[model samples]
Target chain A: MTETHWAYAERMDAAGLRDLMLAYGQDVWNLAFILTRSRDLADDVSQDVFLKAYRTIGTFRGGSSIRTWLLAIARNTSLNAKRTAFMRRTILMGRVADSRSSPSAEQEALARRVSDEIWMQVLAIPYKLRETLILQAKYEMSIREIAELLGISEGTVKSRLARARRRMMDAREEVEQDA
Target chain B: MPDREPEWYRRLRGNPLQEPGFTEEQMDRIERLAGERSGASRRRTESRNVRRSSGMEREGGERSEMGRSRNETNGPAANETESATGDRVGESHGYGESRRGKWSGGMEPVAGSGDKVRTGAGDGRTGRRPRRIRLRAAAAIALASVLLALGVWRFGSGGADPAAPGPSATQTVPGGGTATTPVQTPTPQSRLGEPIAVLQLKGMLAEQLPFSAEDVTGFEIYAARSTQALTVPKERTYVLLQNLYNLDLKAAGMTGVGPDHYLGSSESATLRIQTKTKSYTLDYDLATNTYGAFGGTVFRFYADDQVWLLMQGLLNAGSIWAEYDRLSEQSRIEAETRSNADEPVSKAYSPERLQVAGSDYNGWEKQFLPLSSGIRINDSYMGTSSLIQQLGNDEPEVLRVGNAIVFATDANKTSDGVGVGLTRDEVIRKLGEPNVKTNTRWDYRIGDYLKFHLLFEDDKVRFMTLTMPF
Candidate 1:
């Protein structure tokens, strides 16, 4: 109903969708980039988020700001994509190593792969533990803030954090021993 | 691990958790998405509140109809939502695979929500079964993979000029947030101004004969019957005619209206009755008596607590309807007399004549008819008035069948008006217009007559007929 500007509605269009994809696309790709460790997978996830958001925007009912609603969609889409990728890989290529086949010399790809391997170990932990570790490791989000975001008891946050760290440490030891 | 936390855990507490996978572009998409969703939610909430506050007026007899009109306007907005979902699915169709991820694990629940009206109605048709929804889901997965590879091409490429809006008003959302473009007007009629003319059907109600929804032919038969009955007695005619209109609605099972006397069953039922009237509006309540009066005076039998009060409760809609017929007959007579008195024709064209035109053109009124050969040519057209009985007047130029009149010329083409004398042949060759006739009985444009009737034989002027002047 903004007579002067329908900027938000326009953004829902293809060009607007593209303008948006281009403008803040890197954040989405980076999120996808980190989760999949494959640039292509990251790009795919970024586009999916927009596609879903564009489709469902009509039902948004605008209770909160559009930015907030979109972020929620982003979070949901990312988590779902990550889980599906995990299942498909597990199903098709039984517990494949996170290590790249080529192990190319480029530092960035290496950095991404090594981080992804660590994250894969992180994902192996239980939901409670994984949740705490992701907030701490990936987001650098403080425990208090993470507690607020997840709407959990801070005590639960504290306990989960303790368990996640132990898991990470155990995972590091196993890798080291194997090496 | 330590008591509260291991030292490494403590270090982690302050550490900025690396956001595992979101790239800058991903964040932007999320931001814009949130903006749009919020905007839609706000609009819906505002309208809901508006409807709530308007409830009292919405139910009011007159206001309820207006509310229905407004609801019809909201249909386009629903279509907009459908298309948006369609485009989204089409985009997903390109993603093919590699969509598996942690969050994807539970999405079976979210996708279960029935949002797939897109594929069913996205192409502008509606109604797809749940099967279609599942089918779309499969297509989306494949399409998603395709779009992913194309995504690099899409995002890696530079942004050029924005895509121009589609050729439709809703190249985006169905009706809202769209712009209009001009279309060319191709004809002189288009330039003539407001070519879209309507005879104001609602207002035309009281102004027409048998002003009801009954087809013209059936009603004409009824009107002829009623006109025959009109001479019976004024009071009885009133009782019969009104019953006709009332029975028409009653048979249709319509009720509920502005009041007890004012009623309609549903909007559709109301429209059926209303189509006969000049206008369809919330103001219909005032029209019950007002519209009928304009057509002519009423001959309705008096309604009193004695007869009306008793039957008013019993389906004495019969009485009201009978009264409509009586009043309608009275209205018809008054209009005929007034019409006949004005120019010259004695009455509205007989229902038998009207039966021929096939069009519902009701108001072809009487005017000063220029008669010759008794031929009525394009009575609806301008500048000529004449009527022909049988193409060639053979029988004694008098119509002896009913209350009819005949006037003919005495001289054969006198020089009085037509510059020279002539036989029927010469008359047709020169003054082919109705005013010139063969017999002297044809007066030149009867100074103050209503029309001239020309009687012809073998397509040649045989005699002249004229409407006697007062």
Candidate 2:
């Protein structure tokens, strides 16, 4: 196996980046699919993500692995894209709600339980916490890799995930109590 | 809570994550991207492979087996990996991907924060925005509980833990298993004599010198045997002394101290602290063709390679000029070869004299041992060391001889310690000197600095060296 960026995240020309992305395309796409739950979102975000990585790789100081850097970019871009879409929909809905005076009960219920609610919640946490959690759940990365990828103390990562778990537990307990 | 941490860690021992969707295509893609990002660096890997394959073709293509042989030559023995200095030991398996399967306690570090992120509830999206993010945070916590339960269940079922880190993460340096090291202990001969004493005396000199040498210290003379094959007759020793003393009087850097009645000249050259110093003297005795040649008494008042590096360190590092370059570590054998190059002199003859030994491959080969110690080294850059041994020891004193020059070392183990690089001129001037001297090169060993009569033709100080580490 060959490692390219031991020194730092050096910049790549477009064609070269294309080859690298193609090599890691499935991994990146799969990651995007899980994050966005949309094939179109995964594609658009992936292409955009690689270009962004290409543009800024020069600034990468190499404190972390290249995969971590790329994944971090993909994660952030997808989240922002999701946010922008939600905003656009919000604007559209406000207009529709104002025109109709009130949304129907079924429509309100459907709006509350969007098709990707579970995924949306999973993506909602802070980056540090979410990354560790996802690697454990999806990529099945060990604590060592998670620590290496993010440049965090392994102890810190563990506690952060532990906190995340506790937070989820409390959240569930509250919801159940309410129910 | 801290103690409880270990229990959570214990779970990692039982439940290992299945391999992710890493495939050959993925690895290839990564390799290509690495290439595009690093043109030559990536190219070097493939080229090296190609070079290896092509190298095999030249030898009838028994390449795979030959490759291992060549690779072994690069990192000769497993023992070579024990470097005295511990800096370069790092990860193994130079793969390009970042995310990997869980190693320690089955927790993969999150890849660095990327472009994907969640938005605040009030960031313009209408219905998708929950009134409070606290709800989303709660959902995340819920996900964690479920995963934990799953991990625990897996653990209970005797599945391998995804978190336990490999030995690489947990091992210590002594057993870290790197492939090349220079952690050799010197022999008792090194501990017994002037080298050890000089090492101790170096501390005192270090207090005097203003600077220090980088990396090299604790030099031990591996051997100090005498050789007798090259000894000139006693009468010739007197004649040689006369010629050398005359040469010193005419040397450009010399300044006479007393009247010409003493019939000798003194050479003086300024020295940079921790750098090479340039000066000494010579005297002639008319009765015999004997000239007592004495000059170039270098004294580095510093510790270690400060003086030596000062003299020879700037000779184009990474250039072919270097005695040793720091690039190959893939194997053990190559490191051994490189180590030999770094040393100026290696062998010490068992007896003081020999008629013949070693081949005359590059430079002069001499029978060495007994009265004079010799070192044969390739005088030019990129050249191999041939021989350097004393030819004779009529007096049985261990002296250094090389090229066509010869000199004796005068080190002292005082209360301050074993002092190396003390001036012979100062010693002779105070002691009223030798009844005879050799007309050999005006040589000096001042600390780590070693200078010989490099300019027999230039009656001036053309052979001055100022790079001793003191």
Candidate 3:
């Protein structure tokens, strides 16, 4: 087997770690953004993920790809960041505001771009389903890989995908009908 | 069996969601943190060596002096020294324990360790000699107690414990502290609001059709399993319908092919057209590209290669159309259940059963390999290069340079198939082991020479070559 990036995880120097960051920085940040739904939080989570990865590189057992491993870190970090009381209150407030039909300025801006609108739809799903969909679609992770990453069963992954797709189609139908 | 991704999914994959890039300052901060950590560890190692070499030479004198100083000053300066030393020792011990696989309870342990270390160092330097030694032992006991307490509190509170169960790593948040309250950290609300669905047409198909894609009301396709109402945009529905309208059987040179020529027993779907006054249904065989509409009599016309491809593209763009057979089985069961429930069986449908004809493998062979989006053996090197570039940045594994180029599959990017990204087992299961199998190359001999081969790296099919004999 070809040596994966994890081969150097245990003893990676600064330059080696920098290379890893450059390779997966965008991916890690993107996943963080998807989970947190906040760019600033994503930035923090990305930094923490890389630092955590570097600090604890020795603990990695090479069971999964380095990308998968880093993504898992990003996921956990984002979730933890969200669980902070400050984030919880902000999210609660945001949800309250969202309950109103008035779209936020950011939402209007996002709707202006078809691609951004697609991303918004993806983010609008419940966290679990949204995460599973992004992992499958954006990351092209196999059902098995997603299941492993999310600590869910393969059947759950498939079902979530079905539900997410159905929701997306329904949303698209609504938009088309409105148009 | 994995089905091909739908058109929307492919679009999403092609257009990656935007992610905010790391600022230069952020990069520098992380690098600095890494440097500090390495530096700290190196200092820790040196300190340990120094202590080992010196043994207890100055231990007694330092202890007496520490006690006198502690008695003389128990002020902010002492507190400062205590907290600073606590922080350093805590960080060092956290790193050391993480290496031993004992780091847990998130970053709390580091903080807790700092607290204990501070207490121990405080007592050792300030307390009477006997008390100092006793306090050291108590500090050790307290360290374990704090770790246990933190673990219990973490699980009990269900709070922001960064060390959630996942792939192993240091769970501690950098700059260890309890979850900050909202007042201290004013985080902004998530910008992404409620999900808004947007319609996106399949690329290239809308552009290819020579029709004003307006005035089309609705479009639906009848697949083997169930019918799907395609959500074609208002401006694009005509693009699809115009293709059907343009297939005029009465046009010049339009020849009627025999039922045997057009009709086949392969899978097919029907397109239903609805107008204000009338409705028409056209049946098209997927394998043969033969389509017919029954009016007074069956008008079977063979669609040209271009028209057939456009039709395929339309069908492929729809969700659930690609996995026709699988969904057919599922719907068959559902249909049986609905029949029992006295639901309308009219909605239940299957591919129109037609007379079996000669094999269509030749027609399939004339097309590109189904693995990739569009790649065929004997395609010009430049053409393949352009296609690969369009596919993505995945560099194909080139072996024995020729007209053919093998594209490597990226698990993170490419959809799973018997294509470049397929694992060894997947390729073997799809197309059995080759005639000649080496470490990195699998060659299948057709007749005499190797007609089909796959080059592997890291146990995944990197390059695939399939050449048809003349």
TM-score of each: 0.24, 0.23, 0.34
Give the lDDT ranking, best first: 3, 1, 2
Runs off by more than 4 Å, candidate 3: A1-5, A85-103, A109-115, B1-4, B14-20, B23-25, B38-470
**Docking quality tier of model 2:** incorrect
Give the number of the best model, judged by TM-score: 3
Error of 3 at B227 (Å): 58
Q: Which stretches of candidate 2 lie over 4 Å from their true place?
A: A5-15, A33-40, A92-129, A140-156, A166-179, B1-470
> lDDT per residue, candidate 1, B1-470, as tens digits?
33554433444332122443444544553444434443544543343344345331111011111111112223311111211111222111111111110111111101112222111101112212211111001100011112222212322323222122223221211101121221221111111111112232221121222332221011100010011100112112112222222121111111222122222111110010111112211100111211111112221111111111112211222332222222222322332122111322222222222111221111111211222222111110011112322221342322110001221223223222322224555654554433222222222232212133343334433333322210
TM-score of model 3 vs. true structure: 0.34
lDDT, model 1:
0.29
Shift in Å, residue A139, candidate 1: 2.2
Error of 2 at B94 (Å): 37
Q: Rank the candidates by TM-score, best first.
A: 3, 1, 2
Q: List the residue pairs that clash in candidate 3.
A: B107-B172, B409-B421
Residue-by-residue lDDT tens digits, candidate 3, B2-35: 3866656665563334434555566665666555
